[model samples]
Target chain A: MKDSSVAQRTVFFISDRTGITAETLGLSLISQFEGIPFIHVTLPFVDSAEKARETTQRINQAYQQDGAQPLVFATIVDPEIRSLLEKCDGFYIDFFKTFIPGLENELKMASANVMGRIHGVGDSNVYNTRIEAVNYALNYDDGARTNGYDTADVILVGVSRCGKTPTSLYLAMQFGIRAANYPITEEDLHSTQLPKALRPYQHKLFGLTIDPKRLHAIRSSRRPNSQYAQLAQCENEVKTVEAMFHQENIPYLSSTNLSIEELATKLMVISGIERRLR
Target chain B: MKDSSVAQRTVFFISDRTGITAETLGLSLISQFEGIPFIHVTLPFVDSAEKARETTQRINQAYQQDGAQPLVFATIVDPEIRSLLEKCDGFYIDFFKTFIPGLENELKMASANVMGRIHGVGDSNVYNTRIEAVNYALNYDDGARTNGYDTADVILVGVSRCGKTPTSLYLAMQFGIRAANYPITEEDLHSTQLPKALRPYQHKLFGLTIDPKRLHAIRSSRRPNSQYAQLAQCENEVKTVEAMFHQENIPYLSSTNLSIEELATKLMVISGIERRLR
Candidate 1:
């Protein structure tokens, strides 16, 4: 029997387009087998037969070197190129082939078989929507301009270094949501009422608070030994902002342990904000 | 026979986490059947039996109303919750179930079965790398600063509105690549040589050019009727920039028809920049 625990395997994520979908799903799948280490090779733009043959050779070489069959996860929409890849020595899994037929049958229509349609700019309207949202996020970031709050789908309120900027950009880039973030300044933190700028758009406000230690560490890296980066200052700001969220009845969450994805998702759920584009 | 051309169907993307993976893969799969109208519903954070039951009810209600089963694409990790979803009145496609067994057999190990592990902040190092990269992209965006060019993974040089900002941010957000962009100015377009600021980092530079008509339209939206938005001026700038790219031998691509995902992927392939994070 092969030594399953110690043997290292090579995995390939090949696709006709950017390979993003293949890599994303493949990464999530491989992450499950925690102990095994995987050497990943991504072959994107494998749309033609020539590129397919080249990738096949690479996969074979990996198999020969490792003395094991490499696992290949492919998401090619082109049948000709995909069939060429099937001749390779690796254990091939075609994401498109497995599901496209079911979908075609269900819809009583033929699959488009269009390459790069998923990640490419297939729909100009959708593409422009995302670009505009990204611009909106940057323009309104960190309360850079409070006048644009009326157009924001969601306004993130929190102290500096509490993870508002990244969350705002993530919402915009990923979901085409117009997100504006305002830093809860020390002056505002000392009071109980909501800031004058944020009071009008109170319905769009979502509060983010971070742990004092984490906030201090994040701030110290940017500006070391400053009073703003002190642990006591961080603690006071977090405490006051969280209390303001409670008193003002603003929906809030902690970003101390959550990734931007989790934080954005939580904000979307809490605010009942529907995504503008998919 | 059922009328396939006009009937509307509902599709649900259910997951224990953000439902992003499910939605992404499902949208790509369904986009193949072009004519079918699908009402998309995303149910994220369905980690509990109660939530699963509620989603099941929603799915069944859709089925009852449409007189057709809704299509459910799920990526839940917990077996108990997934099994409960399997009983829903819809066409159940379990993303994890279909692939986990094959992976387990290959690795000779048990799957972790961890909910939210894929999209969650499971690895703090990976999370921080992306956040830092995003900050780097913003700080160096649009030639905002010239000092950080040495630290960038790739520096994008292009004319204004040729799609550099989004591509830079997408690189940082998706692949943890530190990308900085510089907008080619009126003066830089008049000359053949690379800009003095970009001279030291010629090896790290990639050019982006867009179709002149598209460029004019894009600029016109931001600044109407200005000389910068004129068709002739856009044509002149694009021609000059393309000529400069040829002379400098800096790798370049047209962003006119490509999405940000496609642009970033092509840049990675041409520049041989491996992703820093998965």
Candidate 2:
């Protein structure tokens, strides 16, 4: 492998819970390396020593078959299980062991050494908050249930198919914020004033706009060849919505090249909405 | 500072884009240290030197006030701006710098050194897939558009408030999978048979059940004092759903103490649904 005999390597993300932490940090690190192709295998819920041994067997098999030591990234909290994984025919990168010692040394404290906590439902309160936020987002989606705008943490206003719904849902699910989204119709854009229903919650209002070409592509997929999906219509709608945002002095972001996660967190910072979870 | 004079440390999550990566890795490492309270601050979209300078001043101010080197976790990829930030009076954890050089030496290729592309909209296809999946989940939520069941990657069947809606949405939003959910009514539960509409899609079926007490609490919030919120009703529904799942050989999981992320990914593994993104 050092002589470049193999271009691809097997990478295992092992965790006692969901393996999300292992996969996340492993992927971020792997993305830094450009030429080496990695085949990622995420093995979750490996909580028992038996499960760890089985996973170790798989890792050894990968090493044998590939004729190179595999890269294993693990967050197993149990020392015995970590030792078992360490004995495998792989270059082990223990996320917990690597960072926990440094932190313990820094703070002069011991870690909890528990499993299934990070990104897991070990905390009932956090789980309930996420579920409640999801429900809230679903109920208030697309300006469907506008009665609870007073309770909303933020209100996203945009033209049809301008990424309001997904951004609202993402903010709710990830941040535990109740986000209500209202569609900015042509009438509202023409009126040059905030919607009658949203006027009371202007402080919580944020706006989204998108590139006309991309919006046209998205709208065309939904309603093919309709006047609504025409390029001119998309262009007109985007310009009008952005102009309305400017006139109203409402902070806005363009969704042309943005993901829902990006839009959600950015708008939270812009509108000063507090995220419920750390 | 080494004598541990400070009770709390100021931590800044700075990035050229959304700052999600910095926050995520920083928080994960921070959690391992049990007792030290951290004042978490996020500064996003610091793409210019001016913004970097402003952030540096803020960091210096925190250093002066706290009388300790502030912990600055940065994901900035711009060399010039990063050098400017390195001049600040803080302990900087440069994510890009710490890992990219090793990668370049390993792969014998220089990094792109670009900003804000990892979690941003650098890949339009990925962004569109997420949006498309979210829209599908919303449209197919709660069996509202059950006719498209044939197109679903997985169909979740459960009683009311057993976490079908949130799990379906989470799977779609995170994995870009088309998920359709159906609610099992009392009639179907009593009859001890799968819903007629879901019979043909049995191979794609997955089930979710929850603890009666938790279900009761959840239902009570939505429909207080109703028969639906009664503990007996919740218990009966759970028993019926589990029996049906067992009889039909449909793989199932408990949502009682699981987060939506866990439920979504685990069920995807059970149902063999492929994730759209790497």
Candidate 3:
């Protein structure tokens, strides 16, 4: 199964704090080169000079093993450590220093150059807001509590296994949006109308639907051989719920092919929901 | 209450897809410039020439209002659209094009130049893995069910409201790790040994502890004027659980001043848990 024609490379994500920002940006950059397979190593909390030197040796060892210079994507804030990493036997891309100058010149002020500020616990209020949103999502998940619908920033509605719970949690955790999801049961699907609990929050509603075949597979994994997992049952539920969404004028999307990030972002845009935290 | 010494600027995150990568990298880049207050606007799903032109006029209008060129962070992959954005009235930072050439030269292949590939549903197996992880986290949350702990990658043990749930969810959602959390009840804390259920899985345990004062505040917010929220009660419980962690020789970290991302990353590193997906 191996493709010998394809190339292989070693990549590192280096940072002083959590290497999330570095990894995310680096992954996005390398995703463009589809023909090469990258083996990733993340070096987080590389703050001290000794750690930087050790990381340089590791990169060198990787180069020796692979017969190619490893690619290093770094977000180190300390100038001394940053320079040491730059001297390593690899192709180094400095994510921080490369863009700081343009921002400094445009803003007419110097950067604080503080380490661990990006992913650290900055602005206690924002941190608390995010935690609160996560708690809200859990408390209001899957129509467990309809009394709290008024406080929700957006309410997601769909049939069972239509990808509502994960999307709600993603909205809350990533953006501090208080999202609640309500599953459209078979009874509600047959009624051809919105559920009574959700009728009052029509303005805050967004719908999600999935292909019947995908729904069948997802449900079969959860409850194999049950009536709920039958393909005909899934088809009926999806068809009825989609009809309800269309008749009620609710904006919706297919969750069949979209990732949670794409679904959350698209839902926020379509519903005009403002994120409470950045 | 606005500080007159702080400068004001408008920033734009423009992308053909979800714009999450552009926004995250742009935010990290701007967080360094602490003296400026930025107003952020994200234009996602701009996949056509008309939308690009409209975005240009919008950026121009922002410049006219602020009397300064806005900072635009873009990840548009189309050469024509990328060039169009370059002509906008802003300090444009092309996140994709700026780094593509170096990657192309190193890989010795033409860049795929694909739009929406980074955050899109590239592989069904990875997507399903993340969804399955999310479901596992929810199912095993708060010691809801311990029968499935044998299948978990990591079991987070902590006191009530000690930030076990959010960290577990983040580990699952962000990195596709099947994380399960157990809240150490008062009965378990009074005992001098590990819980009966956790004895067999000592190697999979990771402890989370928080400062008593902070825990008291968080608990009070949930149930005010209760014995559980008293400072003395929090102090005793924290001391006991921390002693238990020490006696058991379990790896642990403080969640007091750490964000979810930071906590999850540190835990993953200390526990040596490999991420299932990149």
Candidate 4:
């Protein structure tokens, strides 16, 4: 038999959303336990009872073979399957346990304070609506683009080569944000004002600016040493565009060192965009 | 001035990857502390001293205007920029702060253990290599198949219509795993073995299966009522494929209810793939 003291504990993440959310959350939790040797297993989309049984059997086998109880970190939404997992012989950390309590508390608190305009809106419906809205925003543009800027949850503005595309795409894919980005040209910078239509929705405007050197480097990779990829031009354009944002009082973030996830999340938080999923 | 308790706190996510990673981590952390009124701002790609100074200025302004200290959660890579953020009058939580001690401890432990394979691999080099590998894996296929399976960190096996594409992509983008997927056809299922070459790398093999009904539903979305999308056929195929996996003793995860994120994270954990980034 393997030494229980040193034998790595097996942890499983069973979920419906491909287990990425659970896995990411689990990894963060595992990081807190510094010296623990744990083997993590992710069993995603195990919706049916049969699959649950199979997973349980595998967990039992792993424990029996190793003489150590494995930890199962799960985000199972279905009631029946979650019950099935509960019967398994292992330590389980369920995200639903945490989510339900928090959600219930929020609902209770909100219901008590019936002063808000949308006070009577049920929490479940609100959450569901937000999720649907996010999904709609994400898949809003298939190809054809009419000037329907009002539909965007957040509008990203930046100069050329300011890391707008990736940031927009990341927000869409990760958080289901319908993030629409428009590059501020030299003309717009010189004009010293945002688009006339954007004036009313300035609250939704978020700007992205990058260092000219970095922009030049990124652009040079795509079009080496071209006029568009010149360091001087990039620097000048970035400065002008940033000045325009400052002059117009448009809040902005620099894209020189931040990751796409950070930028999107920050925008969501700042813009009061509630996340659809935890 | 706004009521101290009612005023929204400013939260910042600063990172090199447009703050995407920091934002994801921060969201998870914030989720743990529900009901905290905080406004999040992302300073992505803030790799320079000038940009950091600008970020500091924003934080200072937010504090002075709001009458509450801003909470900064940063994932900066540059030491100089990180130091600059540290001096900012806000509650700072750096990703590197959580990772560095653990990494140092890991390095010391590895170095002490003369037989450890990672004894000489510096943490920075490992991180850079993993980032490069992840990027390489993400763009592995320009939607075109090549003989790139040889370099894959993990090869996913499943029947057609089972979630292989999204899971593979998530693995590549999130953990930087070069994930290549191959569909197991009836011929292979009947043969009761993985691809002959894959047998040698069984340790890196991951299998994704789904409920027959769900598989039918998914396939029907693509091809309605056809034999390929028939429930009976799907049931038979799933049974045959799962039995084949069981017979071959290849561990697998069901993809019926799990999300893409959960599946990728579970695979990373179960397959013993080391995470390069926190």
What TM-score would each prediction reach against the true structure? 0.97, 0.91, 0.98, 0.47
Compose the digit string of candidate 3's lDDT tens values, residues A78-138.
9999999999998899888889988898888898888888788888788889989998999
Reference-based lDDT, each prediction? 0.90, 0.82, 0.90, 0.64
Clash counts for the predictions, in order: 0, 0, 0, 49
Ten-residue region with minimum lDDT total, candidate 1 chain B = B1-10
User: For residues A56-82, what per-residue lDDT tens digits would candidate 1 score against the true structure?
Assistant: 999999888887788899899988999
Each model's chain A TM-score: 0.95, 0.93, 0.97, 0.61
**What lDDT is reached at residue A5 by model 1?**
47
lDDT of 2 by residue, B1-278 (tens): 33565456788999887887788667766765666768889888898999999999999998777766678888888899999998988777777776667556654668777665566675678877877777888888887977988778888898899999888888877778888888888888867778888889999999999998999998998899999899999999999889999999999999987877788878866777788866
**In order, what is each prediction's RMSD in angstroms?**
1.7, 3.0, 1.9, 12.4
What class would a CAPRI assessor give candidate 4's docking?
incorrect
For model 2, the DockQ equals 0.50
Q: What DockQ does every candidate get?
A: 0.81, 0.50, 0.84, 0.07
Per-residue lDDT value at B75 in model 1: 95
Off by over 4 Å in 1: A1-5, B1-5
Name the regions of candidate 2 deviating beyond 4 angstroms.
A1-6, A35-37, A60-71, A88-91, B1-6, B56-71, B83-92
Give one digit per residue, the lDDT tens place, for model 4 in A142-260.
Answer: 21242666777777788876756556655654555666767677666667677665677687778888878878877897799798899888988888878778987878888675555
Better candidate by TM-score, 2 or 3: 3
Give the higher-TM-score candidate: 2 or 4.
2
